[model samples]
Target chain A: MTPEEEAQLKRARRGRNIALALVLIGFVALFYAITIVKMVD
Target chain B: MTASANPALPAEWRDFFALTKPRVMSLVVFTGLCGLLAAPGTIHSVLGFTAVLCIALGAGGAGALNMWWEADIDAQMKRTAKRPLPQGRMKRTDARDFGVALSVASVLLMGIAVNWLAAAVLAGSILYYAVIYTIWLKPRTPQNIVIGGGAGAFPPLIGWVAVTGEITLMPVLLFALIFTWTPPHFWALALFVKSDYAKAGIPMLPVVAGEAATRKQILAYSVVLLVVSLAPWWIGGTGPIYGVAALALSGAFLALAIPVALRRAVEGDAMKPEKRLFSFSVFYLFALFAALVADRLILGQGALS
Candidate 1:
């Protein structure tokens, strides 16, 4: 692969990893909140 | 610089996001929120947010699946050639898997967090759009949009059921409103983009039935849309706020539709009336649904019986 193509692929992988991390964190937080609400109700 | 130019490079996160059809999701989210708000009941703000989120996620999943399924057709069409799958930015398998994951997660989370009925309806809407409309109807029939309109009509019903925990007449009227409105709205677009659909080999009404027949169908659907839009008010479900808004909005809709219906397009014609009707139709639905929620919240109308 060309150096530029490799660099671009690296950037895309990094961006996807960060987005996946954020989504996982958000999912966990949402489930926790839902559980608390259910218990209180 | 385009993703298609470098196949070895992985697609950026934004490409996956684009698969969700975010612009369309915005309308789905809005109508779902309106239905939840207009329903005569109270829900915790968090649960309300969760319900809307599930609706948005379900829509996103369905859209992703649609792109995955139609990638070949999309590549052939000018309007959809730039999509991630069509442009070679994402693998079809990745899109299909992403769609399945989102669809499953949304339904499960809805059932766990909200109610089973809402979750089941959400699942059904996904299947309706992805399987029934995309796979079965779109390629085979010119009447595809007519039957497929039911898929988009479910959001308000699901949202209402989320709150009220039962199907009711008011939500059914909302469903009917969208179901009737889709043909005119879609066919106006089809008239203008007839060449693109024809190139893709999709049997859109304008492509299969000819422009005159499609325009007449648009007018007929608009007439039906007028009655359906006003049904909530006529049934005493909403107050004069929504009733008056429906009258004004649908009146304008029919007025714009008339010129598009009556005039035949000549060679080199701009299709201005058809374009105008398409734009107004989107605004009409948004405004009509917004008025429904306003009638409930501002006028303090009780829940529909």
Candidate 2:
């Protein structure tokens, strides 16, 4: 594969990784919020 | 799209997002949020937000599954030929997996965070659209949109259930409002896009019943929608504010629909009336719901009293 194609692949991988991380964080926060609300209620 | 055949190619985030049908998702989310806000109760803001989020995710999931299943049919129709799965921008298996995951996760989270009733309704709605409407009805029957309308009507009801933990007259009325409105809303578009449905072999109302009958049906459904939209006011569920808004809106809806019903389109004549009604129908729903929320906020609970 050409260097440019390899670099594009790397960029896509990095972007996907960041998106996955954000989704994980969102789920974690959502659960935390729910738990806190339940505890207080 | 040519690169999609390569197993190693990464799907663009936009392609995956397109699988969710974001424009339709936005409408679902908005209606769901409005229902949550308009329901008669106090809910923790965070919990309310969570419920809306779950509704949005569940809707997105259903859209993905529908697209995944209909990719082949969609490819044959000009209207949906550009969808991610239809265009080969995403693998059908990947879309199916993503849809199922989102559906399950959203329902489970909603159950855990809010109430089980809301979650059950959410799950049922997702399956209604993806399995019942897309898989069973759409290809087989002209009544697909008629019955499938129930799927879109669930969000507001689910949102209300999230707050109240049960169904009530007001939310049910809201459900009926959308249910009765869908036939006309969809049939108008079907009138203009009859060829697309014909090519796809999907029995849309216009394709099966002919344009004349479809026009009559559109007018009939519009009248029914008019009655249903006014029920919330007549049954003492809302105040004069919403009643007035509904009256004006439904009046305009009928006015727009009348021309479509009365005037037959000749070859080479623009289907301007049908197109106008279709556009107005969308705004009509949003405005009606907004008015419902406004009335509720201003008058407080039991505003009709």
Candidate 3:
């Protein structure tokens, strides 16, 4: 692969940690917010 | 000239207007507007307009920066090769600079016109998509769109905060609906655009996960999305009318997702289901939010303005 392609794939890889973090955060809302999950509140 | 043949560039000067990712902006507008409308407190008409303006500007700014950062990879991908920057009609530096300007200006305007909270969320979203997601995640990970999707989901929540000056369950439901909807929505496109994303060296889910895993994930997310979409009505954020409508729409969304989820691309299969899901996902979010807004309108919920 060219430098551009290498850089591209490498760049795409950096998002995994962020994605995991965000997904974990969202998942936390599911478990914790279950009691108070009022839609109109 | 390339501009002549391009569909977005009309004969009139106004034709250039559509290229700013107007369809996406309209979604931002509608969601933000719904957030403001659904809020219990009063926001002045002008402030509400300013809030919507901020969402549009912020969303557009992020899109521009996204285009600027991805120009090289976009040029390689068939799906995005024809975007303005990659097409050579627009200067790369110009896009970057313009994106920076709009992003900063929108944040500032929102802070001045609405609560600082909305502006902060808008700023964070812009940075999330432009720098964190685009510059960091997109080229590197299979999960890029999953994380970056939050950038698109912020508009309604921000708008709700803009009007009410606080985050609440209803707005959070709106936020969750969009957040959960993102993966299945983009994964559908990734199924067919697998080649384009791979050729661009981007690790989209279909490219990274393989088709079966991608399909399973799509179905999983769609189911979650359907459940979350109904939360507003279930929790009293909206009435049964909106709930029933959302259930119906999401049933259709699931119907589209299940086939793709079950099918393997290795067989003699066309990419129609992915395409169909992609098309319906567009309508799914729009109409779901529209139903919410319409519910408020019918219930004699006072207008935001």
Candidate 4:
């Protein structure tokens, strides 16, 4: 692949990683809230 | 325009996200949340959130798959030409895989996390939009939106079932309200974008039946929608607040539809009334659902179960 194509791939990968991290964080927060609610109940 | 055939085309995160049709997902999520909130029972907030999340994801997945199947048709129309698949920013196979994965994951998660009934409806809805509507009905008949309305109506019903664990009158009413509301709402849009459908070779109402016939049908559907929208309150399923809001909103809906129905075309822009009614229809659904939740919260136990 050309250098520009390689750079594009890298940028795409970085963006995907950030999106994945945000989703994971959201899941953790949701699960934590569920646990707190379950404990209180 | 030739879709990029390059195997090396790196799909951006935004392109993948666009495949989900996030704008459409927002409405799905909102209606689902409203249904959850309006239901009689209280759920663990986490599970409630999860149910809405699943609804959003399921709707998104279905939308992605619809775009995948309709990519060629979308390419033909100016309105949809800029979509990720049509633009060739993402491969069709990648979109199909992403859609399938999300659909399966959402349904399974819903079943494990919430209840089977909600999950079942979610699965059904995903297939209904992706397969029945997108692949089958849309190209074949002008009645596509009329029947396909059921798919969009599912989120609220699923949300209700997620909380109540069974189908009931109120949720059924919610479903019917949207189902009935859709023909008028979408037909109004078709009136404006008739040329787009013609170019795409999709048999939308205006293209098949002509603009006058489409306008009359819109009026008829709008009338039915108005009556159905008020059913929740009349049946004692919701409180006075919702009843009042439904009355006012449906009044506005009918008022807007009247001009579009009577006038052959607007003087300045033929699409003006159609556009007005179309915009108001979205707000109408949101406001009506919001009122349902508001009534339930404010009236406490006095609100009907």
Candidate 5:
């Protein structure tokens, strides 16, 4: 692959990774949301 | 990826991993854990971990089977064109055999090591995803994701069954929450990947219904998911902590969905909001399930007996 294509691939991989992180964050936060509420109760 | 005859090459390892759909498996396992945590009874430590392991392996097995079956069509989609099967790093028959082995072995392990209820659920999940979703619903209709969504929703129910040895309203509600979430979540991906679906001759909602219809359905489903996510709290399955957090997150999810639903269909950018919703949807399910676990366990709502 050309340098530009490699850069593009890197960018795409980054985006997918970011997307994955967003998924995990949501997952964790959902639990936290419920947990935090319970902590107070 | 260039296939090498070298036994220790890093590239071949990737093929094996890709066949399992690791990202999807992570989500499946997490949800399964949440189900196990939220069930209204005690589970032995060894049995708990074994149930989770079997679920993870079973999910991975089912995913591998999906790739093996869809290898031909996968090469046609940009998002999936480079998968191990399409890239020829893994042979189709090899993947199929591997999937079958894992599927049966996981079920057997779960049955003997954990509870039969959990094992049955796990076995059903594999069949639902590998056969019902992949082979039946996907190609036949635009509502494919709707029906196929059940496969993803099985984790919590299965997890619950792992502990209780039976089905219950609470886990079923959790299952419903994820089932409702899948359509909107996937429709968002479908919006952006419509061209890929179209090119591959797959009939996703965004492709068949057009942007306007897709957006409408997304918003509609989001509204329904928001309501469903909140039901656990209202129905007394979860405490107020879960109720409040689930409601707030559902509101945020809806806020994100509203704009996508209302946005004018821009030519190149029609997919932007859908993409955002897709990104958020992943978070939505994870957060919601986590909250359920947290409230029950950490906050002492009902985590441990």
Candidate 6:
């Protein structure tokens, strides 16, 4: 593959990884919050 | 080209996001939120947000699965040709896996965070849209939108169940209202975009039933939608706030539908009345739901006893 195409692929992968990380983090926080709420109730 | 085939460009996160059909998701979220807010009794705000989030995720999952299933069909249509699956930005298996993951996650989260009833309905909605509507009915029958309407109609019912932990008349009426509203709403757009379905070989009402019959059905459904929209008020599920709004909105809906129904199909002139009806139908639904919430919150009307 050309260097430019390789760079584009890397960029896309990096972006997807970042997004996945954020979503996972958010899911963890949401579950934590729900647990706290349920316990309180 | 299938996703397995090498593509010129790599897929990005945004392509994956597009698979969710975010515009349609917005309406789903809105109606679902309206249902939650309009229901009797207060829920903890955190749980409420979780419920809506689950609804959105379920919808997104269903949309992804739908795109995965209909990639070939979408490629043939003008409107859906740019989607991730169609454009070869993503693999079919990737979309399928993503959809399955999201659907399962949403249902489990909802069951844990909210109520099992809500989660069950959410799961059903996803399956209804992804499996029943997209896979089974859409390609096979012209009445796809009519039956498939139940899929979109589930959100409000699910939302209401999230709060009450049980199904009731008000939520059922909300379900019926959207179920009836879908035909006129979809048929109007179908009237204008008749060629899209024909080109895709999908059996949309306009393609299978012809423009004349489609128009008549649009009017017939609109009339039914009017009655169904007001049934909530008639049944004392809501107050005059919703009643008046429903009456005015549905009256206008009927008015717009009448023109589209009566007018002969013209080669040109941009199908102004049909387009107008389509736009109004969307607005009509948004306003009607907003009125339902306003009736409960602003007018101090509680949920039905």
Best by TM-score: 1
Off by over 4 Å in 5: A1-41, B1-11, B299-305
Ranking of all candidate structures by their lDDT, best first: 1, 6, 2, 4, 5, 3
The deviation in Å at residue B194 for candidate 1 is: 0.3
Indicate the residue-level lDDT of B10 in model 5: 28
lDDT for each candidate structure: 0.91, 0.88, 0.78, 0.88, 0.81, 0.90
DockQ of the two-chain complex in candidate 5: 0.03
Q: What does candidate 1's lDDT look like per residue over B202-267, in tens digits?
A: 888888889999999999998998898999999999899999999999999999999999999899
Docking class of 2: medium
Q: What class would a CAPRI assessor give candidate 5's docking?
A: incorrect
TM per prediction? 0.97, 0.95, 0.81, 0.93, 0.84, 0.96
Q: Which candidate achieves the best DockQ against the true structure?
A: 1
Give the per-residue Cα lDDT of candidate 2 at B48.
Answer: 92
Clashing residue pairs in candidate 4 (N, C-alpha, C atoms within 3 angstroms): none
Indicate the TM-score of model 2: 0.95
Best by lDDT: 1
- Please tell me which model should have the higher lDDT, number 2 or number 6: 6
- Residue B164, candidate 3: C-alpha displacement in angstroms: 0.5
**Model 3 iRMSD vs. native:** 15.1
Lowest summed lDDT over 10 consecutive residues: which window, candidate 5 chain B? B2-11
- Please give, as one word, the docking class of candidate 6: medium
lDDT of 2 by residue, B221-284 (tens): 9899889999999999889989999999999999999999988879987899999999999999
Error of 4 at A35 (Å): 6.4
lDDT of 1 at B144: 93
DockQ for all models: 0.73, 0.65, 0.02, 0.59, 0.03, 0.67
Clash tally, candidates in order: 0, 0, 10, 0, 10, 0
User: Per-residue lDDT tens digits of candidate 5, residues B77-104?
Assistant: 8889878777765567878987898799
Candidate 6 off by > 4 Å: B1-10, B301-305
